[model samples]
Target: MRATSIILPALVTALFLPATSPALAQMAPPPVTDDVNLSLQVEDWVKAETARVILVVDLAGQAGGVNRADLLKTAAAIADRTDWRVIAMDKVSDSAGLDRWRAMLETRLPEGRLAGLAERAKRASKPGQQVRIAAVRFEPTLQEMEAARSALRVKLYARIKDEIALLQQTFPDRRYRVQSLRFNENSGGYRDAAPPPPPPFIPPPEIQMIGDPIRTEVIEEVAPANESGSGQEDKMIVQAMVSLGAFAGPTQ
Candidate 1:
């Protein structure tokens, strides 16, 4: 009866909700007959552990144009001959919109190696058919992504535990236990989806999502890494359901 009491008012209010409830329609009513609990969610950023640097090589020289076959051979040579582990990245694409092609190369690219790679590409260039480095971009490696996810989970767990501890301290008479937990992979943010995504928010004493039973994870976008690619972040969120019951300490 105590658990049902916690959700009854919400269901009643939902039923009385006016036509404007369509706006509220996105907010699903709380589940009745469920354990009474407090739901909390937390989000944090995780810096990537590794990065892959990409270099674009333009085969279209000033005079004629670098031959595709020769350029591929050059790519092989660059990978094999270079001390720096430069290797072909992906499929070739249109260079400047003509028969010419652009090649993408990848490398571990430790600090201070950019200059060496650029100089090597310049030396490979010629008047009629030149091949030179055009641009560079940073990409997170698979390992780095995994690392970020792990970091995010750890952070969220720590926050949830803190919140649970606070709740226990706040209401010494009730015994609280975690009922459920859900983690969001994509950064949590409001979106235009059917049934609608919850607004960007966090769990608090008074959560606004209007649901009675479950708490959704709160995910936020991570700051993008700058040019150097020294630091990259992938954020994550975890939602926790904590139910409480009367302590009924030592039967009198």
Candidate 2:
């Protein structure tokens, strides 16, 4: 029994002692800095002369273990591209920090349809999902967006020509020119229809034309003098002339 007790204690110690298995010995520790893999896909809106750059960050493995600063820094770094405006979504990170970052981005970039998009993202997300950042490059103006919509489904090559023609017509006097037009398969073609034409140009009532005043002409007539050679005749003629002048006087 004494021998058995000693052996049992030894067996327990041996079993409890750590063993260096190949899996543990060869495994690499995760990075200390919360480094997430970032993948970028750039799509160009050829007609709009804009680009949509999608920045997909892998947050699946980072659950409950991502550094806020690192994530934000990563986002900011990705946004640094000159041709892209970063739109962060699926951000399964610190909500407050993400909101703050979004606010800061709004102040910095202050462009595109980011406000509406951000609002939509915020509404869609649950409590804690990694924000997926979508960056738009070369965003189109209202006019460009309209043109793109109109030219939807036109082959990429043909779309450029159509856009140029439209631009020429829309801005007849302006010396606008399109240097190049690129197409991206990811953007899924231009929108089907152009946004409704800006409300027709309705002239203000105050600006309506006022008609010119009516013109008038006056005519004078004289009666032949009586054959009788008398002072009364002269007086009669003078009276007649005076009457004619009075009738033909400038109209009021």
User: Best lDDT goes to which candidate?
Assistant: 1
**In candidate 2, which residue ranges exceed 4 Å CA deviation?**
1-46, 65-69, 75-143, 146-252
Write down the lDDT of every candidate, Cα atoms only.
0.48, 0.34
Candidate 1: global Cα-lDDT? 0.48
Model 1: which ten-residue window has the lowest total lDDT? 205-214
lDDT tens readout by residue for model 1, 73-126? 665443333323334322222435445334444455443333444456557766
Give the per-residue lDDT digits (tens) of candidate 2, residues 2-63.
89988998877656655465443345332222111212222234333333434333343443
Count of backbone clashes, every candidate in sequence: 2, 16
Task: Supply the TM-score for candidate 1.
Answer: 0.43
Q: What is candidate 2's CA lDDT for residue 90? A: 32
Worst 10 residues of 2 by lDDT: 233-242
